[model samples]
Target: DAGVTQSPTHLIKTRGQQVTLRCSPKSGHDTVSWYQQALGQGPQFIFQYYEEEERQRGNFPDRFSGHQFPNYSSELNVNALLLGDSALYLCASSLANPIYGYTFGSGTRLTVV
Candidate 1:
């Protein structure tokens, strides 16, 4: 009965550096999605993962990458981080299709100094 879990809770990175955030999906869920939420802004979908593959992506640059493991856990990797990359990174998980429902983690607050 575990819900989605995100690591570090908070993070701080320097511009031009790289960092990776992790997420463990809720039980009974097979899909994972990543989102970025800037201060005062709604979450913006970054990408979706299903069956260990990237099923869909949003309007983000190549600097963003991700991975889904056989265990259904996922990771979000940001390279050459910029100040704009600082935000709350959320991880949501659902069934095969998220149109039904999903659960979100508290997210990892990232700050690019």
Candidate 2:
């Protein structure tokens, strides 16, 4: 009964570099969603994946992409990173139905120098 887990709890990258964040959904969860949370701000949806396909996306640019594997694990890739992209990347997992809220990971803090 583990919760969502994200790797590289913290990362430091430079502008123009690319970074990939990883996440493993909780047991029995089939949907995975990614969010970006800036300091003192709420989490902003990036995209959601289900059945190994992207089902919904947020206002982020194409540089932000994600993939869900058959095991319900997921990855978030950001290309040409910008300083503004520095934030806490959160991964959440839940069932397709909204009967229950999402279970979030500890989050990956990215800093672009």
Please list the residue runs of candidate 1 whose C-alpha ends up more than 4 Å from where it truly belongs after superposition: none
- Model 2, 1-113: lDDT tens per residue? 78889999999999999999999999999999999999999999999999999999999999998888889999999999999999999999999884889999999999999
TM-scores for all predictions: 0.97, 0.98
Name the TM-score of candidate 2. Answer: 0.98
For each of the candidates, give the backbone clash count.
0, 0
Residue-level lDDT of model 1, residues 1-113, one tens digit each, is 88999997999999999999999999999999999999999999999999999999999998999999999999999999999999999999999966779899999999999
The top-ranked prediction according to TM-score is: 2
Cα displacement (Å) at residue 47, model 2: 0.4
Report, for every candidate in turn, its global Cα lDDT versus the true structure: 0.97, 0.96
Q: Best by lDDT, which number?
A: 1
Which residue pairs show collisions in model 1?
Answer: none
